[model samples]
Each structure stands twice: as C-alpha cells, then as structure tokens.
Target: MAYISVLKLILSVYCFFTLFILCSTAPELCNFPAIFNFGDSNSDTGGFSAALFSLPPPYGQTFFHMPAGRYSDGRLIIDFIAESLNLPHLQAYLDSLESNFTHGANFATSASTIRLPNRVLPCGSGFSPFYLNVQYGQFHQFKSRADFIRTRGDIFGSLLPREEDYLRALYTFDIGQNDLGEGFFRNKTIKQVYASIPDIINQFTVDVTNIYWVGARSFWIHNTGPVGCLPYILTTFKTAGKDSAGCAKAYNEVAKYFNLKLKEAIGQLRKELPSSAFTYVDVYSVKYSLFTHPKKYGFELPLVACCGYGGKYNYNNEVTCGYTLKMKNGSEIVVGACEKPWKRVNWDGIHYTEAANKFVFNKISTGAFSDPPRPLKQSCFNPS
Candidate 1:
C-alpha cells in the first residue's frame, strides 16, 4: 500500500511540473520593456488635480491613502499596465513636478482632446467654440510630448540619458471617451457624431505618427468605452426609456463604429511605420463584459453606482458618497451607500471602483496584453 501511494504522489508531481513549464513557455504577446502613457482622466494618475485643486472627493481614495488625482478609487489602466510590465506605476507628467522620469511619463490631461483645440477652456468644463483649434495649436507649439521628453532628459540626464534605447518601450493611449461624452454626444446627433469620426481618427493618427517619429515604437491604443451606460448621462438626460437601454444601444453603436475605424487606422500605421509595434486594447469590449457578466467577475452590482444618491441613476458628484444634500425646497436628499463598496463596479457616475479597475487590469493583462500583436509580449504580471 505504501509503495502504491508513493508512486501516485510522484506521478502527480510530474504532471504539475509539466503543466507549469508549458504555461510559462507560452508565446509572448508584447516585448515592451518600459511604458509611457498619454490620455485623459481614464489614465491620469494625478495630472489634473496637480494643476488644479478643485477635484471631487473619492477620486483617489482606493489604492492611495489620499486623492492622487486619479478619477477612480485606485489605479487606472496605466497603473495596471505598468505593474504588469514589472515596472513602477508611470508617474503623471504633472505629478512628477519634483520626481525623476527614468521609467515613463503620463501627459494626459483631465479634459484633453485629441481633436484640434480652437479655444482654451477650464479642465472638466464642456468644450467651447474653437476649443479644438486652440488646443491643437497649443499641442503643436509646445511640441507637447517632445518638449516634455526634452525637459525630462535635461533634468534626469544623469539618471537616465535621452539616447538610451526606449524603442522597445510601450506607449498606451486612453482618450476619446471624453471627446465623445463631453462634445458630440452632449450636443449632436449620433449620425452627426459618426460623420465626424473619420476626421477625429485622422487627427489621432497624425499625433500617433508624430509619437513614432519621436522614438515610440510599441503602442497600445484603447478605443472608447460604453458612453451610453454612464450614470451621469443616464440620470441627467432623458433617453428613450426608463432603463436607459435605448440610449446605451445608440451610444455603443457609435463607439463600435469608431473602434472599427480605429482598427483600420492602426493597420495603416503598421504598414506606414513598419518598424513600430502597435496593438489596440478594446476598452469598450472589456467594459461591456464587466457590465454584462458582473456575476462571473465577482461583481455584485452592475447598473447602480456604489457612490451617489436620490434615485436609481442620480449620482452625487459634488457630495461625498455618504453625505446628504439639501434641496432648494429645504428637504434633505439622503444618499445611501452600497453594502460592499468594493464589489460594486462603478464608484461614481462614470468611473469604476478600485476593485473594478483591478479586475479590468487583470482582464487586459490576460486578454489583450497577452495576445498576439500586443505591446508587452513577454510575461503577464499581476498588478500590485
């Protein structure tokens, strides 16, 4: 009996070792050694709040003890990507007001637009006339990212030189959601917005091509998220019906159209810049999966936000999650909190909670970041 048991134990051990080796030796998805980010609040580690101090509450209350300017409770997608790459979280360009930039930098502003800026507006304030033209001109004048790199090179020359090979570094972009949400969707029809997508995509392509010129070879681009499902839009705006099903469908269709065009654009970029490595991370698909498969992903709530109050979709952006608001009629609007805050998908109207962000990071690491033509192709690391 003892001899038979020993044989079985040895067999199990051998099988475990074999499986581990096979999994470890799987094909790589991306070959990115370092990561740099450029986008809006979705990936802004602390840029907006660093420049302006009027940011809302519960912004960075998840991972960081205090508000780190991130729109989420914890880390954003960039933070997860950096952690997956075995690198420290990429510092915000503004947050690095006193830090070194040896690893990477994030130049995403809260309300930065990829489209040309015609006028300058306060961050988070809706776009005004000439917003695109003015911002685009400013983007060009500052030589934007290049200027940032040069400044960093000048400052951190002793630590990390400019000539050092960053060709293998991954550059991730997560913008355009704000553009659609704050611009076209707020004012124009879906058809009108869809018509302008080509121009918007073309402008982005130009900007990305410029980044390639500046030594960014590997790229991970994220398409727009599901704008229709956002709490702010559903609660504030009167869509087709009660559950916001119609509004979500319409918005998602536009997003899908944009993503399709974006894919083609990336394909063109690959042909145009053969030496550069590019991959598109489908933020829309991932976010949709989270909403549709909340139970599968261990999420308890999918529709309502963990934060906010009043009604089903009435999210309180100005007040903290547990605070009470006084209406004009002298009646108090009491806001209720979710039982398990971490289990809820959304923290506020539009942003995800820390747990959701972590789950999203995991999905990206396993799905997109570990698939063919990804930016980081070696091995996937769990976000810290």
Candidate 2:
C-alpha cells in the first residue's frame, strides 16, 4: 500500500512540473527572431539607391536628418515594423558596404515587379532588374553563403544569422503594384491588365513557395495599396473616371480584384502548408481611408505630393522632387520639398510621407486591417 501511494505522489509531482513548464513557455505574443522582407519601393530600405545613384538630401530629412536611401521623407512601413518588434532595421541585400545580415535582409528595390520587366532600369523604363524571382535567388545565395561563412567561426559569424533564426523569422511581402502599373504604362487596356492578374498572382505564389521551401514559416503579406489614389496615377491618368473620394475608380477596381485573388491564394497556401502561419494585411483599406477622410487622420492634401514641381497635383514627371534645373536666365534652382511634409499624405507623388506610413502602420498593427483578424504581434499563431 505504501509503494502505490509513493507512485501516485511521484506522478502528481511530475504532472505539476510539466504543467508549470508548459504554461511558462506558452507565448502571449509571437517572439520573431528575424524578418526577411521582399517587395518593391514600399519596403526597399536602400536596395535601389545602393545599386544605382544615392538619393539626394531632403529624402530622409523628416527623421534621419539626411538621405537614408528610403523613398519617403523619413521612415518606411518596414522601418516602423522592425521598431515595433524590437528588431534592428534590415539592411538591403544589394548594399555591400556596412551591411550586417545578423537579423535579416531586405531584397526589395524601387520599381520592382512580380514579373520581370521587358526592359530593366535605365532602359525602356525605370523598372528594377531585381524582381521577385531575382530576390529569391539572392536570398538562396545568402542562406547558403551564411552557412558556409558561419562554419569558420570568425567575427563574420557574429554578423550572420543562426540556422534556426530562418525558421522563426517573419517573411514579409509588399509587391505586385508595379505589375499592374507596368500593364497600364505599356498601354494595355483595363481589361488587359485584369487578364494579366492571374499570371501575376501565379508568379507571387511560386515565389512564396520558393521561400517556404527555404524554411520560412511565418508570413506577413501586405496587399498592394490603393494605387488609384496616388498623385502620380491621378496626374497621369487624367481621363480616368473619379470615385466619390476623387480617386481613379477603374484603377481602384483593378487593385480590388488583385487583392481578392491574393487573398484566395493565401487561403489555398494555408491549407497546403499546414505548418505555416500566413497573415494577409489589407493595407488597401487603411490607405483608402486616409484619402477618403484626410481630416479624420490629421492629414491635409491627401492627393498632392509633399515634394515636387509643376502641375495641378504639384507633380511633374519631367522634373521630380529633387532635381535641380537651370533657369532660362542661367541661374540654378533646386525643386526642393514642401515646408510641411508631415501634413501631407503623398511624398514625391509616388510614395507616402513618414507621417502617413506611421498612421497606416498604427491601423494595420492593431489587426483591424488584417485578414483572420490577427495582430502583427501574433502573426505566427495560426487561427483555429
């Protein structure tokens, strides 16, 4: 009888310790070790600027106090995300000088598209050569080289990620806007652009799968924002029909269609990759809200560029935000930025101001603009 009693007591103690350990280890919020970002200008920290020419002053005036290689006057959405998660800002993969890959890397670049452009940068148009597939290739090389270098156990090892960090890392994507933009700029009709979406989405799916094959498990994919509301679009497509919010109606419809397809693809991916957690962020809705009700969000002139020259939208493609032009009287004059960039939504007619990016980040980080309604902190947890 004493032996049986002792056995029961041992079992009880074991159960108590097991429960305590489980409860203690259970995460209240996701603990992401790193972030691997892929996309276009929206998330490009300095990829394009490093590959091409360095952006001039006033580009990062609002926060960095100098040119920081970001398209905005200050920080980008990805910058805010890294700050929220207590991770260091990701350096561009293309940036060879002073780059540390310990946390993660950003493969995004300005004018990047899902599909490879017909002509690359400084050619037919200003499209980036580092498209989605190229970015994946770069990532593949990075992973392999990182492993090879870490085996040496030198100081370089400390500047690279641990093998397990890739599995726990959050993979972020904010691409595909340029695909639609490409179709439109190439003189493809609205119907033609719509027809091209399936192929665009297929490429996106393939790229995501490629990343997954490389051991990425947590995904935070942001759908493209409302391109129709951009000052560049509004200024260029002058004949397009306008919505109640003064945005291009047909262009927004195309964006909605693309978003719908992307959502569906994510749902399929969830079922296919049961071990992975995919979070679809509806940035389009949050951005559209800013345009519709600018005053509600403490913004004015939602459609105008904070820095540009000429035209009704204060944007002229011939003379961009930072260009210096020689006057007919033989005097040099810089275009310069607006006095108050924080009060405006658009920056240089193509990107958002730092203030606008922060606002969008605030809204989406709450999970209100996310599909499955999961906050960014809990993105690794799959919804039951």
Candidate 3:
C-alpha cells in the first residue's frame, strides 16, 4: 500500500536478462543480470540491522572498514556471487534511507528461519520480517511495485523491468540453518532433528513454488553448510567423543541429512518445473574442507573461533562476539575480533570469515558444487 522503491530491483533484474543475452564466455561471466537472495546471516547484507540487531565494530573492519551489520569482517558468499557476475552488491531492502538497489534487494536477516512456526533463535525473534515467509511477503511487495512502475511507465522511465524480466531473474535461497539450529540448541539429537527435515524441505518447496508462480525460474538454493564445524555448535554441544577433525559429528550429520533431503526435494521440484533451472549448491563439502584440510587452504586452526575472547574455541557462547561482561573478580571481560581473522575459518563462533567465504564461493562457482553441472553463470542463464 505504501510507496516502495523497487526501481533498483527491477533494473537489476532487467539488466541480468540483458547480460545473459550479451555474454556467453566460460571464464568471464559478465553475462549475469541480477540476483534476488533470501537467507539468514550467511548472505544477509545488512537486513539484520535494518530490521533488528545492530552489529558493532570489528564486524566489517576487514574490508568494509566499518561496522555494516554484515555479521562478518568483509564480503559474504552473496557478495562474492555479485562480484563474480560483475553486478553491484545488493542493498538490504529495509535499509531504504540511503540504499541503492541498482543490482537487487537482499531480503535476508540474521537468525532468520525458513519456517515461521519453528521457534525463533534465542538471539532473534520468530515472526514477521525475519522468516523466509516474511521475506517472501516483502518480495511480493517488491514485484508488485516493479509491476506498477512498468505498467504505468510514469517517472522511472526506462529502468522499469517488464513482467518477464522479473520472472527471469535468479532467485537464491540460503536459509534453513536456523530452523535446525533451534532444534539442536534445544539439545535434540541429530536423529531427532532428522524427523523435521521433511517438513522443513516441504515448507521450503512451497516457498519456491510461490516464487515460481510469480515468474522466477532461475533458482540457486544453497544447502546448509557444515554447522557442526561452527565454534558455537562445537562449544555448545561438545561431548567427550569428537570427530577426527575435532568438529562436532552430530551437527555435521544433521547438516548432511538436511542437504540430502533438500537435494531430493530439488530433484522432485525439477520435475514439477521442467522449464526452470533449480541448482542445489553443495556448500557442506566446500566448507568442511576448510576444517578437515585446513593446511591445504592456508588456515592454521580451522576449528578455532576467530573472534571468541578468552575461550578455547574463541567463542564464549555466553558472551557472543561483541560487548563485555563484568566478572566476579572485579575484572571486565570483553568480546572482540581476532587479530588474524583472515587466516581463520570461523568468525564469532557462528559465521565464517571473509576469507572462508571466498574459498567456498570459488568452489561453488567451479561447477562442481552445483547439480546438473555447469558454472553458476551458465545455470542462471540457461534455465532450460
């Protein structure tokens, strides 16, 4: 009902379609037009702060040079995707004051769950503006605004995207970790969490279908990464027994099961939408490699939390990675970033460092992490 600026979104979508028509090289994929992403902190651009928490200093100190609510020190996987495509990084939809939508809008937020009924994380709320369903609602609003401008052709002029343009744009989903996280945090075993996989993937499938009905045919859905390797999970769920890699076996097993179900759902969805390109990104193997084979990737301690203060894992689950606490001995303990964040795998116990993000992105774009085997650009461009 209110006036929403969707010019950036429309232009971005339209430009991507133009890219597909223009470029076709295997090495340089300048042929990318735009991407619409829905996910949690892993791909969040700044939705966390725009809608909820304000990430403080050292969060973006590595590359952004300031705290941008990114939950990381630099670019995220989504940022790398945009960089690979030669598109401007997307702006968080809620950060409208000085936001630029030249590329597209990011509807992701920190601790966002795929299904709303699932309990919200202890750090975040459960409902509107954070769930994928809520994000989808916002996207519907975005599409409507784009439709309005294109139909009227009033003030936006040529930047408006035709309806088909919006339909053809790439839609990426990197959510679901928090949904399972809720269960794990509750002390549910991996087998217990497995029972919810079907419902989770089913809800995800419904959301994808909702977008497909609106014309989005290019889908890049990232399966959950290796959550057990996260410092937070390792610390919170550690037992006497440990994996050979020192990572939590239960959490990773949960991730594997979820990914398997997600892949199957995508396979079935492919049959449902024969003309659409639905690629499931295998981020687990890529991310897990950083832990299992840290030396090969130049990481010294892949299991250590890059920013945890005064803890074995560098992650004080009780204290997070920001702010300070007063101790019993009249001493104050503060949480902050690591000195060598670039060389570490995990960031703040939960997310990955920028260096790790780039590594995963590189592997994914190599055409190996994707199903149906093709570079991300080719899959996006050729949805047939």
Number of the top-ranking candidate, with lDDT as the measure: 2
Better of 1 and 3 by TM-score: 3
lDDT minimum window of 10 residues, candidate 2: 375-384
Per-residue accuracy of model 1 over 309-375 as CA lDDT, tens digit each: 7567657557545467888999986554465768888877777787887877777665463224343
**What's the count of clashing pairs in each model shown?**
20, 0, 3
lDDT at 49, model 2: 96
Evaluate residue 193 in candidate 1 and report its C-alpha lDDT on the 0 to 100 scale: 81
C-alpha-based local distance difference test score of model 2? 0.92
| Candidate 2 backbone collisions, by pair | none
Query: For residues 1-384, what per-residue lDDT tens digits would candidate 2 score against the true structure?
Result: 999999999999999999999999764688888899999999999999999867887799999999888999999999999999999998999999999988899999999999988779867566999999999999999999999999999999989889989988989999999999998888899999999999999999999999999989999999998999988898999999999989999999999999999999999998988889999999999999999999998999998998898787888887788888778999987878998898899999989999999999999998998887888998884433
Clashing pairs in 3: 16-33, 167-215, 308-314
| Local error of candidate 1 at residue 230 (angstroms) | 1.1
Give the alpha carbon lDDT tens digit for every residue of 1-384 in model 3.
Answer: 222457777788999988987766334432446678999999999887876668877788899998886988888999999888787888888886676554567899888888874455343535334688788888888878877766776665344345656655778889988888878777676777899889989999998888787777888889998888888887777682568899877778888999999999999999998878888899989998998899898887888877777567877766777778789999997777778888988888889999999999999987898897777887663543
User: Regarding lDDT, does 2 or 3 come out ahead?
Assistant: 2
Could you tell me how far off, in angstroms, the CA of residue 31 lies in candidate 1 after the best superposition?
6.1
What TM-score goes with each of the models?
A: 0.78, 0.92, 0.87
- Candidate 1 versus truth, CA RMSD in Å, comes to 6.2
